[model samples]
Target chain A: AQSVTQPDIHITVSEGASLELRCNYSYGATPYLFWYVQSPGQGLQLLLKYFSGDTLVQGIKGFEAEFKRSQSSFNLRKPSVHWSDAAEYFCAVGAGPTGKLIFGQGTTLQVKP
Target chain B: IAGITQAPTSQILAAGRRMTLRCTQDMRHNAMYWYRQDLGLGLRLIHYSNTAGTTGKGEVPDGYSVSRANTDDFPLTLASAVPSQTSVYFCASSVGSSGANVLTFGAGSRLTVL
Candidate 1:
């Protein structure tokens, strides 16, 4: 069985400040990781994904995630966050080509002005 | 492009009533899924279909039923709605293999059984 953990239930960051959301996963084989964002009343949107290749992957809205194989972690990062970035972020892991994603509890990001 | 559209944005139903949530995808993807989102549980899969005519159970499929008669539609039905089943339901679909494919999600259907 595979699982994902986003330790922090909530995070607050000042506008223009750097932000990092931690995500850890448990999987036996090489895992496929993804970061998704859901704005108020909106659907989940893919921020970034890592299958295989360079460990560091960049995504939309200046978002990026580093896949540390040894740590079993794929944490999302942003150099600076905007007020509009206030949303819920989810970390998910897929077993294989099935695309069945196991999601983390989620992290609510609040951007303070 | 209209990725996925879920009907009845939100609904409140009485216990023991029957309900079917409709989901459609214009992308013509080969796979579709249904998930329920709670405050702290994130998203749990209820059912999924790899392709047309085939459906499979997911983590939490006890109270739900699904049908995949065609490529574009996958509807989830609750045999007997219960208060515990009240949660925001999401419909998603993917193309080809998921290793590199991103599953596009619908806005979601909020169901509340009273």
Candidate 2:
């Protein structure tokens, strides 16, 4: 079985400040990782995905994640966050092409002004 | 055209009553899935269909049943609604092989069992 863990349940960052959200997964094979953002009262939107390739993958809204194979971590980062970035973020992992996503509990990001 | 549409966007049902959450996708995807989102639990898969005629159970499938009669429709049924079943349900579909495709989701159906 595969599982994902987001260490922080909640995080607060001021506008224009850098941010990083930690994610770790347990999978036997090379994992396919994804980052999804869910705004209030809306369905989740795919931020980025890492199948196989470069260790650093860039996503929308200046978001990017580094896949560290040795550490089993794929952490999302942004140089600076905006007020609109306040939303719940989730890190998901799946094995092979089964495409069945196992999601983390989730991390609520609060962008303080 | 709606990429995916769910009927009765929100509903409140009495416990033990039967309810079906209708899901339709125009994308003609090969796989469809049903997931429930509860507070702090993220989204948990309840059932999935790899094709029109085959269905498989997911992580939480005990209280849910699903049918895929064709490529465009996959409806989830609750045999007996329970308070525990009161959560927002999302229907999603993906193209090609089950494990390799990106899922497109419907807006969602909010169910309340009282």
Task: Report lDDT (Cα) of residue B10, candidate 1.
Answer: 97
Q: What is the lDDT of residue A64 in candidate 1?
A: 96
Top-scoring candidate (lDDT): 1
Q: Pick the candidate with the highest TM-score.
A: 1
lDDT of 2 by residue, B14-108 (tens): 99999999999999888888989887888898998888998988899998999999999999999999999999998888786434467777888
Give each model's whole-structure lDDT. Answer: 0.94, 0.89
Q: Give candidate 1's error at residue A5 in angstroms.
A: 0.3
Candidate 1 structure quality by residue, lDDT tens digits, A36-83: 999999889999999899999999999999999999999999999999
Model 1, position A105, has a per-residue lDDT of: 95
* Model 1 ranges off by over 4 Å: B97-99
- lDDT, candidate 2, A14-100, per-residue tens: 999999999999999888889989888777788998989899999999999999999999999999999999999999886455457
Give a tens-digit lDDT track for model 1, residues B1-110.
76999988999999999999999999989999999999999999999999999988889999999999999999999999999999999999999546556889999999
